[model samples]
Target: MSTKYQLFIEECQELLAELESALLELEIEPGNIDGVHRVFRSLHTIKGSAAMLGLEDVRELTNDLESLFDRVRSREIACNPKLVTLSFRYKDMLTEYLQDPEKGLPQDKTTQILMDLEQVLDAPVHAASRPVESACEDCGSCRPENDKDADILLRLYHLRYHPANKSFDSLDPMDFLSQMQQLGPCEIHASPELVPPLDSLEPSRCVTSWDVILQTGADEETIRDVFLFLDDPGDVSQFREINVDEAAKLRQAQAAQLSGLLAATNRPVAPLPADEDDDLELPEPTESSSAPSSSQPGSPAAVSSIRAPSSPAPPQAASQEASEAEPRKAPPAGGVKAEEIASIRVSATKLDDMVDLVGQLVIVQARLKQIESELHNPLLTSVSEEIERLSGDLRERTLSLRMLPIGSTFNRFRRLVRDLSSELNKEIELKTNGAETELDKTVIEKLSDPLVHILRNSIDHGVESAEIRRAQGKPAKGTITLSAMQSAGQVRIVIKDDGGGIDPDKIFAKAVERGLARADSRPPDRDVLQLIFAPGFSTAEKVTAVSGRGVGMDVVKRSLESLKGTVEIDSRPGQGTTINIGLPLTLAIIEGLLVTLGEEYYVIPLSDVLECVEIQRGDDEPERIAKAYDVRGELLPCLVLRNWYHMGSTGPEIEQVVVVQAGNRRVGLVVDSIVGQLQTVIKGLGRVFNGMRGLSGATIMGNGALALILDVASLVTELEQREVAGTGRNKRSDRSH
Candidate 1:
């Protein structure tokens, strides 16, 4: 596809999103001028871009819709609930159209929407376009009636039209003429004489200009408004008011001179008008015509417009593009504000490439620093340190580029909730907070499916019927709140619903029946709630279209785990359930606590660590699998790493314990020593290591060795699944493998 077409597709999608958002807002505040403007702008942009790309079907559809918005914006037609509903349908249709780039919009749907919009607008839909009309009334008056007492002066403004660098293959000549009429009725003449032959012509270049005569009573300022958007950097100076007689004389002299040259060269001159063919009614030729006897006496051989063989005549397609303005460049504010506001759209592929390059640079910088430190030379040390600082800054900025607000992901669920509510016959409202919280784009994409399943579960199973809610002394409407917040080095997302909550007794019974729990087992609330995450586990009474066809919560858990994230569930039987998901701010890089275990390096995510403490010799190493550590008078179970992974190294006389939190549980990790904190880019281990119990990912270190990134949650869960001898009768947790 052409680059312009690709841009159109991307831009169309963005416009569709904006259109949906605006329509939804209109549903809330029908008279919001800003929302109406937003909808209008989005529709207008889609129409112009579709036209430019020759997507006629889409152009026609948007043109009809744009016509309707114009009426709504002018308050001629009210924007009501029916319109909002139809607008959503329109969004859905455009989405389908853009999905397949080869095909335009569906023929049937496009026709139907056009017919419907045209009927509502009380107007006819044209496949091509209409002429622009003067904004002022068509009384043929030169000035406003309110200025009757003032001296009425007719100012002739000479305006010229030129095309941009983009192709103007479909531009109409008379279209811009109508737009110019808004100032007042004006006579337009086209000059295409400068156009080259078809074989030599550059398609993007314009070889045409229009000679316009304005008969407006309005001042130069009002006349200038008609051409404001059409003016480019240098074009503005070409537009100014000329006296009517001088303009007419200028035209006559030029025409006479041209006709004489054409007659002398034995070339046929284009016919001038005996009468104006247009509605503008051009005036009869002045006395100068009688003096020009260059040709036969009765010949009407005065040139109106010279056109190339390949170009369409000016009248057939008026300059349709003058009304289509290029995007505006906002004026710079204070230097700081300008810097803060400037931004450009970059493709995901480009950003990913930058990230990869930056990662390589970081590794190379670390290697250089290592070599410099070994050399122990003052000059080399200074240079290495400076390069290291620059690389660190570049890495931080690169990673920050991957961080995007969660709001865009959150916006998608609005449509899902609306449709689900309708299908389930429930009065449910989705409330969101902290949507501006940022997370990695990769994480957001991975979260989409899981989020969808979670929301489906909430609507289909979490919320109760309206009658049940009222009976329970709650409001008739159920609310599901989706929120996000940034804490530490993690983004926390909470999906909570105010509905019938899970019952621990029922969950325990179900788990036992499914062979997931022992028949004699009596688990606590948290353990019972976790049974929902077991594969193929669901509490829905019977299968329905919405959910409970047997695939859900477990998938959510797996998806989060793949991102090295964790999910936890909290519920109160009569209240509601809230599922909390914790994810790293960015998967590209992280702040880690690097430690050495048996001469091997390991990195633990810094977000999980609460504090570090030293342990003495003798009884420091746990005699059994689970050991209890007293930290500030609170006893926490400590998981010994060297023995579990079989590192095959003797325990040091003194060891360090890093207290970390995984979900709601706090535990300690035993390592030989803590080597402080450093930021590292995580690289995934291949499939061979995927099945291993407690490691998440791996990263390269300054010493040209690989360090394993710890999966704190998985480690905690593994410890929970094992029954131990030492840590106060450690009971194996009921967590799934």
Candidate 2:
């Protein structure tokens, strides 16, 4: 695709995100004018840009939707539930078409949807006979003499015109005046009061000027167009529109008989006219009244006097009164005040390029740090320290630029719940919290599908039917809560539902029936729950369109592990189910405990390591050949890395065990020796090692050494599987494998 088209797609995606947020807000408040206006503005902007790019289909569809929202804003029609639902449908269809324009649309379906929209527009409005007026009475004046001969009055002050030297060659003042005359007759007068002498005046400069009287039937817009071409050359210093109605009312109020008659009827009279030469005088009315009567012109009344007395007041008046009553207070000290947000259009490719550059910078910084550590001069050491501090700050700021709130990712589920609930004929309420928690942009993008699958599973199978819930003494509507929080150095996201929880017995039976486990196998509750993460294991009685496809949770687990994260489940048979996901704050850099097994080096994430213990030959042994350690009365299994990876040779008699904890499980990884701590830059294990079961990823150390980062959770599971198979005790099997 062309760069312009790519940029258009990115801009459209941002608009869709904004539209989704506004729609969700509308769903909650329904009468939020700001939210409605926001959605309307986004749609209008997208439609205009799409048209400019020759995306006719997108432009047309969005234009139609924008018009619908415009009517809602004008209060010509109320927003009903049905209209809101249709708006969501329209948003979805537009999003899909924009993402894949080549997917041909069905003409019949498109026609039906448009026809349905027209029916909404045809619905009766409350005040269909009245036409809305756009002119502001406060800024302009109007005169209505018997309502048939109406004239507008205007004022002008210091109106100067400048003509470009080139423009004067092709155009004359007479031609411009002729255009103005078409609107109204112009009576010109010249003032040579400030004119310089002929010799001082350059022929290139405009010396001629005019004062004119204009009388026309055209509106203000047409009158302004006459001077449009003159804007660049010079300025029209001042212009004003006058109201003839107010002038006539002032004349009538000055007549003594009118004032006396109005006073007797308890009606306020209009203001008397001031002398034309008295520019500083204010209009003085006969009485103080808030509004002017239609019979009187030139009344000193509110600017809104032109509005019908029965009509609703302008919404701005209420806002103005509110502001007057309680001025906006200042924010508290040390707080980040809210500022107006501006939306900018950017191409996705640009963002991708930026991320790639940042990644390369991280690698370069790592290399620099290695070089700095080896420098010996004191002056050089100080300079290196300063550089390191600055580089660290830069890296942090750049990474933060790519972090976005999870709220945007969470909002999509609102529509998902709405649609799925209607289809299943069930009542479900989705509650969310900690939506403001931010994560890596890439992680957030990849989280959407997995979250959708998890939510769908909760709604379709985790929650019981409304009738069943009520019978069980629970609320008729099922509730699902999605929440997130940052603890330690990781983000924890929990998806919990107040419905039927997972049954261990059923999972166990399924595992045995599918030959995933032996019938005689007996495991703890936690172990059985972990089975859900195994490939092809599911407890659904039958497959459905929504879920039960048996390809969801396992994939979710794998994806999380690939990011150096872990997923766990906790459930009580009659209570509820909660899925807990713990993810690292960043994937680029990490503090690790570096160690060596024979000749190879590896890193264990500092966050996971509890401590390191030295294991003697016969000090503590729990089983034959397999190493185990007792730390604070807890027995932890230790994996011998030299045997696991088949290292060539061993040198040290003493072995080191790195104790690591993930969730509630603790395991010790035995290595040849501990090599202290180092800051490492994470690198991916390429396709060649993509299927490696126990390694999460690889990284580069300071001394130009390649270190493998172990997947702790996966290694622990592998150990358990081997132990269950009764082959874990065989030393020969471990060495060959």
Candidate 3:
């Protein structure tokens, strides 16, 4: 696809998201005129853009929806649930068309929706029933039917637009003119005199200025809104209603008089290229214009009215006239200047590439430090320290560029909740908070499916039926809250539901039935609940279309692990369930505690490290050291790396215990010696090492050796499971006695 078309698709996706969200909100609060306007504006923009891209079918479908909402905005029709549903269907169909225009619109469905929209529009308005406070305060036309209404008189408007140079990237200026033409009888004049010669002309730029005289019943704001997307529309465009007396003289004015008047108010333009003749012939202006006509000069709708020829006035004289006429054109009353574009769309691939480059720089900086330490040269040490400081700053800023507010991702679940709740014959509302919490772009992209699956599971499994909830003294409408906040260097996202929580006894029974646990096992409720994430594990008796195949939670587990994140669950049988997921801020580089184990080095993520302390280990029976260790008072589980990995070498007399928190548990990781802390650039293992247990990924050491990054959470879990199994066997032996 062309770049422009790709951008158009991206823009449509964003607008569609906004449209769906607004429609959902409107369904909840029908009296919200702000929501009505949001829906209308999104549709209007999509329709205009579709028209610019020559997608007539898309334009037609979107225009119908836009008009429907416009009526809602004007208080001519009430906003209802049925209208929101219809708008959602339109939004979906528009998305499909934009993705593959060749397939065209589904005729039967499109016709049905249009017919429904017509029925809604034709319905009688109940002005007395509407909430008067909900009426749009600033909208002049947004009045109830019983209000004292004045007849809208046709007024002539003179508009001269010199579109901002940057506007052509997204909006076509000609489309604005066509929209005005749709308003009423309009005469369009194009000034080609400003166009530079062939060598200097930009094919994509809108250089030619336009002067239009339109007669319509539309208000001044309506006319001015055509150029609303332009930053500082008043700076480049002029729109004023002509006086009744001047309207008569304007029609009778000669070409010379009209040309002089335009020259006095128009901004100066780039002169023609040097090689071009000064007497180039100019195209004649059209006397009448209409929408959907040929864009070229002399087309059927391009009739002449007022023409500005190639021969121009002296710059000095034109400047004086422009200055004198500028004061007469006052800013519109109560007009707020449009803010400039604040952000631009960037390609994900480019951002990923930039991150990779930054990661490589971090590795090289580490190598420099290694050299400086060995040589101990004053000059080299100074240079290395400076490079280290600069690289650290650069790494932080570069990584932050990929951080995006998770709110957009959170908003997506609203539609899912609405649809699924209806499908399940329940009333469930999805609430979100701390959506402004940010995460790396890559993390967010991969995080989407896991979150969706969790939400679906929450709706299908966690939430009880509305009848059941009411019987239990809970509200009939269940609520699922998705909230996120940054903690330490990790973002903690909690998805909580106010529905029937999981029963640990049921989960334990299912685990035993599936041979995932011993029948004699009696673990803690938290441990049993964690079994729900095991592959092919399910507590459901029968499979349903939504879930019960026991696939989603496992996938959520695997995906989170791939991002070096952890997940935990908490629940009360009679209360509700809350799933907490913790993910690092960035996956590229992290601060790690480097240590050695029998000649091998490993990096443990510092975010999880609570503290490091010395522990005594014996040369013989080193494996016995993999037991509980006392930290101040509480005993924490400890895992000796040399024994866990089954290395040939034995442990030293003294060992370092790195206490790290994984999920809700803190464990001690024993190593031969501590290498201090350093920034470790994470590198993924190849497919050969994929799914390897205990190690999440590999990183490069300052001395150019590869150190496996320990998956502390997984390691801690494995140790706990081993200890539990050993206890189970001992209990069975006691029963035999």
Model 3 / residue 96 / CA error / Å: 3.1
lDDT of 1 by residue, 1-737 (tens): 75656677787788898898888778778878679878987886676556545567777777778778877765667777767777787889988877776876777876777666666776433323222345543222433546432233344455555443334564444444655664555666555556667798887666666666555555544444333223232332244444433344435534544555466669966755544443232223334333332222322212222222222223212222222111123223210124554686799999999998988877787788779878899998998889888998998898889888899888889888888987888988889899899888899989898899999999988898888898999999899999999887788999999988889889888888888888665766887788898998877788888877557888998999998888899999879989999988888878899998887889999999999998764454444446676878998787777766765556787878999998889998888888878677789889877677688888898778999898999988777765321142223333212
Query: lDDT (CA) for every model shown?
Result: 0.71, 0.64, 0.75
Report the lDDT of model 3 for residue 524: 89
* Best-to-worst lDDT order: 3, 1, 2
Ranking by TM-score: 3, 1, 2
Cα lDDT of model 3 by residue, 471-558, tens digit: 9999999999999999877899999998889999999998998888887768889889999999998777789988889999999998
Least accurate 10 contiguous residues by lDDT in model 2 = 302-311
Q: Quick one: best lDDT, which candidate? A: 3
What's the residue-level lDDT of 649 in candidate 3?
Answer: 70
Residues 372-443, candidate 2, lDDT per residue (tens digit)? 667766776776667667766766776676778888888789878877977888888889999999988778
Superior candidate under lDDT, 2 versus 3: 3
Candidate 1 stretches with Cα past 4 Å from truth are 74-77, 111-341, 617-623, 723-737
- Name the runs in model 3 displaced over 4 angstroms: 129-176, 179-187, 192-208, 212-323, 326-339, 727-737
